[model samples]
Target: MTKKLFWEDPYLSTFTSSVISVEENENWPGKFLVVLDETGFYPEGGGQPWDEGNIGDGYVSYVFIKDGVIYHVVDQDPGKGAIQKCRIDWDRRFDFMQQHLGQHILSSVFEKHHNAETVGFHLGTETVTIDLTMDSISDEELQKVELEANNQIYKNLKVQSLFPSVEGLKELPLRKQPTTDEDIRIIEIKDYDYSPCGGTHPAYTGEVGMVKVRKWEKVRGNIRIEFACGLRALKDFIWKNQQINSISALLSLKDVEAYEGTERIYRELRDLNKKYNQQSRLLLEYQVKEYHREAEEYQGISLVSLVFEDKDMKQLQTLAAALNQYPNTVALLAAKGDKAQVVFTRSKDLSLDISKLFKEVIGLIDGKGGGNPITAQGGGDNVANLQGLMDAAVIKLKHEYVK
Candidate 1:
């Protein structure tokens, strides 16, 4: 079995290790299977990313483990006999170490204070998440845990790793039972925590620096807490402060007053919308009165023909419905805006085939429409053809209805 160097020194970024094996695997192309006696490259497992860097002069693309043997998948073969110089990206390695260590401390505190077991864990790019066995944890209780975790950080507690036998592990107080059978690697944070973890972690609590619970939510009868530590926490703080300043300026309000200002603006907009709707209704009512006065009574029918300038389709529909009370009347309404709209309606006896008439009339203006036989509505982007539309409607009415 290949020795895991990360467990000994999580901060070790570079090391010299002898290659134990080199083989070609069908699964990976242009890559060699490099097994080293010792390595600092943490394999991609336990929700943490694999360590990326160089082995000798070649770049290591992927680090994986098979049957307890860690393999460095590199770009070029460093030869089997040569001692490869392995180097890891120290910034990423240390950040992960801090997060992992912080999780151990925080998880320990949760189990100690509330008897909540750490059901799940995930180490992400920005933060680490720990799922508690309980359904919920209030904000006040979460703050207390955060305060306690940071206080432990200030103590500079010693974090030691020990390879204990199954019998030896039985004597120690572990937060969670060990899953492995070979040899349990127990990480102890002084008197605060003891857990069996194979992942790399900080040597001391002070190295973790800080732990901040950024957010939390309940999931599957458990509470998942998302947190950041060390450099990640510092970056998150800087980004959040910048966002607050930007929002304050864009809203033209003090940082403390920004949220209230936004709410006030939303309420004003809603009130304005109500006033606009009332005004539109009144305008449509006035237009309908004018249309009734100008209509000519023909053959026991009120023939209302109107031409409106810069009117919308909604106003036209309102006018059509308002004139519906006139028995045996034919109402022809037209409006000119970005487009020209025509609405034709007739009372009971005069069954105007508007769908057929629209197809013919719309062809002249390159438009399209569909409606019931008694009342039809059609429109086109030919605003200049407003007069033409009125003329066509009159001609079509004379030809189709004035029999």
Candidate 2:
């Protein structure tokens, strides 16, 4: 088994260790796996990613543990060397440290106050998430949790990781029991949280900077809270502040009143849309009467054919249905726009297959559609030929069905 030096000193970035074994990774070509007698590189485990850096001259792309041995997957072979220097990317390592510790504090507060246990955790590239046992958490409750978590960071309490003896474990008030009995490592947040975790963490809670809960949603039977810590929290604030400022400027209101101003504008727009829809229905009724009056009679069938500019398909269907109310009437309507649309329908009294006639000419505009013998509608990208599409449908109806 390799000695996990990272557990000894989480802040350690560089170290010299003897190369225990070297082998070409079978899963990945052009990559070598080198095992060290001792390593400071943290392997990808416990919802945290692996540390990336260099071992000798080769770039260490990934680190992982297999059967008690930690292997550093490198871009190039470090050659057979007795001792090689290895380094972990400090920025990435420190970021994980902050996030991991922030989670400890945040989870402890939830379990402490709300009786919610952190069932799952994920340290993602941009954010960290914890799945709580509770299905729902109100905004007021979350606000209190966030404030308390930040308070823990402000306290700068000492965070200690130790392998406690069996007797020592029984005395401590742990948030949760350790999974293993032999080698139990507990992360104690000084007089506060005590949980079993093997991941790296800062020496003090203040090193976490801050913890911010971005949002939360119910997943499975639990609530998953998406939060950011340290520099991640700062970046999130910066972007959100910019967006709020932009919205306030657009609303012509103070930044604090932007939400109310947006709500007012949204309500006004919704009212206007409702009024517009009412006016549209009234106009369709008037047009239906005019279209039926102007229909051309063919073999006792009233063919109502017309075209409109930039019209909605729903409106076209409404107009077609209204015109078809008249006896022996067939409506062939098309709308010209970026995309062309056509709707064909016949009265219930008429035995013509309107869908068959519409399909034969829909391809002229590169469109597809189908419906019952009474009604059919479709649209296509060939906008310039929309009127021609309608003309063809009208002619096909007169030639094939009107007879």
Number of the predicted model whose TM-score against the real structure is largest: 2
Worst 10 residues of 2 by lDDT: 75-84
- If candidate 2 were superposed on the true structure by all CA atoms, what would the RMSD be? 2.4
If scored against the real structure, what TM-score would every candidate get? Answer: 0.72, 0.91
lDDT (CA) per prediction: 0.84, 0.91
Model 2 misplaced regions, further than 4 Å: 80-82, 312-315, 366-368, 379-387
Alpha-carbon runs more than 4 Å astray in model 1: 23-27, 249-403
- Residues 1-403 of candidate 2 have per-residue lDDT tens digits of 9999999999999999998888996787899989999999999998999999999888998899988899999987777666888888999999999999999999999999999999999997787999999979889999999999999999999999979899999998999988777768999999999999999999999999999999999999999999999999999999999999999999899999999999999999999999998998898788898899889988898888888886789878888879889998998988887788888998999888988888889999999888989999999998888778877887777777777
